[model samples]
Target: MQKSLHITPDKCTGCLQCEMACSYENYQVFNTSLSRIKVFDFHHTGKKVPYTCTQCDEAWCLHACPVEAITMDKTNGVKVVSEDTCVGCKVCTIACPFGTVNYVQETGKVQKCDLCGGDPACATACPTGAITFIDSNWTGLDKMKQWAEKLSNQAHA
Candidate 1:
């Protein structure tokens, strides 16, 4: 059962607790800029959506690495970067479509979510339960159920 983080944008409160937790866990600081997970705020609509690496099964970052610095962790299904092996090529950063993988100037290395080794701090820190560690296979189930309910209501009407 592979695990993944499910984010409900509608439930997000824009509190940035996930950002703080991610930065603190990786950098030991509260700097949101250093956080791998980012919350995009839409001022006009007052909506916020936390975004991060989806840890794709066929990860472009892993394939793009020149030195084989990025490897998949079998346990949690995450592509983790090896700092010692990384040469700061930034190729992996460019390959990622979601723009989750980023280069850090302080370390001259790329960084992204590693599921915190199975105990994701971001999901734990999300006050509104916007982020949840869940079975990867069922990620779309919630959305499907919601749409099914709407269709059922329309059928009865």
Candidate 2:
């Protein structure tokens, strides 16, 4: 019954509503820079991709935190930071391979997606169907990998 944010790059319009919603929900501000989610614009492809923490099983950030500040919610599979315990060492930032972990100068702490306590503002604010909270199995990544691998095999054969 665990759900996660699924993003479709082609459906995004670069409107940044997700960013605004996320910042406002967590920080009471509308600044995109303060948002946990980010919309990246690709000029060549004319695509806007919204990216955030995947909350992967490994959770490098949680393991990398020297102060043991990052913890995973077993029920929802979201990795969260404990601001009180975080020492602002920036080690977790470097450990995150996806570069989603960011340091906040104002708070002197690193921040990333927490799924907004199981109701993500980013998914709710997406004007298009680009971002959705769906059953984790329906993310389509496995399906895409299966088809892509077939294409790769056919090309090689």
Candidate 3:
């Protein structure tokens, strides 16, 4: 049963707690820039969407790595980058269409979300339940359930 991070952008408050938690868990620091998860703020619409690696089934980053630095974690279906193997070529960064994979200047390597070893800190740190760690097979279950409830209410009315 693989799990995944489900993000509800509408529930996010742009608090940046997820970034702080992710950085602290991975790098032992509270730097948002160091965090793998990034919150994109749309000033015009006043919307903030927390974005990270989706761990694609056919990951382009994993395929683009010349050194084979990126590999899939079978346990959680996450694409993990090995810093030791990474040559900082930035090929994976370009291959990823989502632009989730980023090059870290300090380490001279690419970094992205690895689901924090199957227990995502960003999801846990989210105060408003905007980020949730859930079963990958049913990521849309919540939305479906919500719509079902609404329909049920309409039927009752």
Candidate 4:
């Protein structure tokens, strides 16, 4: 049973603990800039939303890499970028529709959330229960789509 990160933006409080944990886990530092997960602050609305790679099934970033640096881990369905093979061309960054794939200036290689090898640090560090690792079937994306469809129907009524 594959698990996925289920994110609920409404529960986030902008504390940025997720970012700190992520950076620490991946880079051995506590720098938000180095973290793969980002908390977006909506200034006008005073809301915070934590965002990261969803690890899409299509994985446009993986497909766009010229050197095939990114490969899907079949066991867990995570798209992992091989830094040794990556050329830092930034094509994967461009191909990523969600802007999750990023170029790390220090390493000159691209980076994205690899689910922390299926134990996501960001999810574990989320204090408000905003992020949870759960079964892929219950990721909440399907519910969001249904809600959007309902709104669309109401709009057309």
- Top candidate on TM-score is 1
RMSD, every candidate, angstroms: 1.5, 3.8, 1.9, 4.2
Query: After best superposition, candidate 4 residue 77: deviation in angstroms?
Result: 0.3
lDDT at 92, model 4: 100
Residue lDDT tens for model 1, 30-104: 999999899999999999999999999889999999999999988778999998999899999999999999999
Rate residue 83 of model 2 by lDDT. Answer: 94
Clashing pairs in 4: none
Model 1 scores a C-alpha lDDT of 0.93
Candidate 1 similarity to native, TM-score: 0.93
Say which prediction, candidate 2 or candidate 4, comes out ahead on lDDT. Answer: 4
lDDT of each: 0.93, 0.93, 0.95, 0.94
Off by over 4 Å in 4: 139-157
Worst lDDT 10-window in candidate 3: 134-143
- Order by TM-score, highest first: 1, 3, 4, 2
Query: Model 2 — TM-score against the truth?
Result: 0.88
Q: What is the lDDT of residue 30 in candidate 3?
A: 96
Best of the two (1, 4) by lDDT: 4
**Model 2 spans > 4 angstroms off:** 139-157
- Model 3, range 1-157, lDDT digits (tens) per residue? 9988999999999999999999999999999999999999999999999999999998999999999999987777889999999999999999999999999999999999999988899999999999999888984777899999999999999
